[model samples]
Target chain A: MEDRFEISLLLDFYGNLLTPKQKTIMELYYNEDLSLGEIAEINDTSRQAIHDLTKRCYKLLLNYEEKLSLLSKYNIREEKYKIALEDIKDRFKLSDEAINYINKLFEDINNS
Target chain B: MEDRFEISLLLDFYGNLLTPKQKTIMELYYNEDLSLGEIAEINDTSRQAIHDLTKRCYKLLLNYEEKLSLLSKYNIREEKYKIALEDIKDRFKLSDEAINYINKLFEDINNS
Candidate 1:
C-alpha cells in the first residue's frame, strides 16, 4: 500500500490493541517485509489465513485511527509546537533554559 | 472501579476499536450506568458473561491507553497551549487581532 509507512507508524502506536495473532502477522508482513506465502510457511498456516489476518489487522488499525485520530492529532500538535516555538523565538529572545524547556516539551510530545 | 469515568473517556476515543459485543456492553454499563443484571437481561446473556465482557473491555481500553496514550497527550497539549498563551500575552502585548487568533488556536486544540 502507498501508506505502508504511515500504517507502520500507526501500528507502533496501536499495534498492542490487536490480538496476538494479528500483531504477529502484522509484524511479519509489514515490519519483517515477509510475503504472504513466507509468513504462512513460517507459521504453518495457509496463505489465505495470513492474508485475512493481515487485512483484519489493517482494518482494525484504521478503525482505531478513525475513532481516536491519535496519529493525526500527534502531527497537528507537532506542527503547532513548531509554529509556537518559532513565534516565541521571534517575539522575545528566550533564555537558554526557556529554549531547553520548550525543546523538552517537543521531545515529550513526540515520545509520548 | 475508581477510574470508571476515566475509562469512559478512553472508551469515547477507543471504544470502536472493540468488538461489537464489547462496545455494546461497555455502552450499557458505563455510559448508560446499567448494572450487570440489567445488561445481562437486555442482551439475553448471563450475568457472569456480562461481567466478564465488562472486565475484558476495561482491560482492552487500558491496553489501548498504555500503548497509544492519546488522552494523556491531549491533556499535556492543552496545558502547554494555556502556558504558551499566557506567555505570549505577558511578553508580546499583542494586538486584539493576534489575541483573537491565539484564542482560535486554543479552541481548535480543545476541539481536536
Candidate 2:
C-alpha cells in the first residue's frame, strides 16, 4: 500500500506481462487505490486472498523490473533528453521556441 | 523463415516478456536461423511441437507489440529525435559538436 506509486509505474511497463487476474488485482489495488477488502469484495474473493494476490502482484512487478529494467531505461532516456536540452541551452543562443519544441518532442516520446 | 529479421528486431523489445522455453526457441529459430527440426532436436521436442511453439511465439510477440506497441513507440521516438535535430540545424547555427551530442543521446536511448 505504501509502495503504491512505484507499483503503478511498474504496471505501465510490465502490466501486460501479468496474468489477467494479476493485472486486474494490480489495477484495482494500485491504480484505483482500492483497499484489499474492497478489491476482494469486487472480485468476490476473501480479503486474505486479495492481500496475498496484491503482495504477489507487487513481487511479480518487482521481479520483471529487476530482470528487464525497462523502467530504469525509461528514466535514463528522460534524463538524457533533459541534459541534452540543457546542454543545448548552455552551448548556444538556442531560441526559446526551439527549446520548447524540444520539450514538446519529449512529451511526444512519453505519450507513446 | 523470411520473418527472421522482423522477429530479431521484436526480440530486442519483447524478448524478456516471453517464457524461458519460448525465448530459447525464438533465439534459436530466428536469431540462430535454426530450422524446426534443429530446434526440436536441441530441445528434445517433436518437430511438430517446435513448429507449433515457434508460430505461437511469433503470434505472441505480435500480440504484445499490438497491445504495448513498445517497438512502434521506439520508432516514433527515433523519428522525433531525427526531426528535432534537423529542425535545430535549420533554425540555428547549432554547433556540429552539439548536433553530434544530440545524436549520441539518441544512441544512448536505443542502447537502453
Q: What is the C-alpha lDDT profile of model 2 across B31-106, one tens digit per residue?
A: 8888999888988889999998888889988887887777787888788778877886777667788788767866
True-contact fraction in model 2 equals 0.44
Chain B TM-scores across candidates:
0.84, 0.89
**Which parts of model 1 are misplaced by more than 4 Å?**
A15-68, A72-112, B95-101
True contacts kept of 1: 0.35
Q: Score the docking of each candidate (DockQ).
A: 0.27, 0.44
lDDT for B98 in candidate 2 is: 75
Candidate 1 positional error at A28, Å? 11
- Model 1 per-residue lDDT at A70: 73
Look at candidate 1 and give me any clashing residue pairs: none
Count of backbone clashes for each model?
0, 0
Error of 1 at A103 (Å): 14
Candidate 1's DockQ is 0.27
Candidate No. with top lDDT: 2
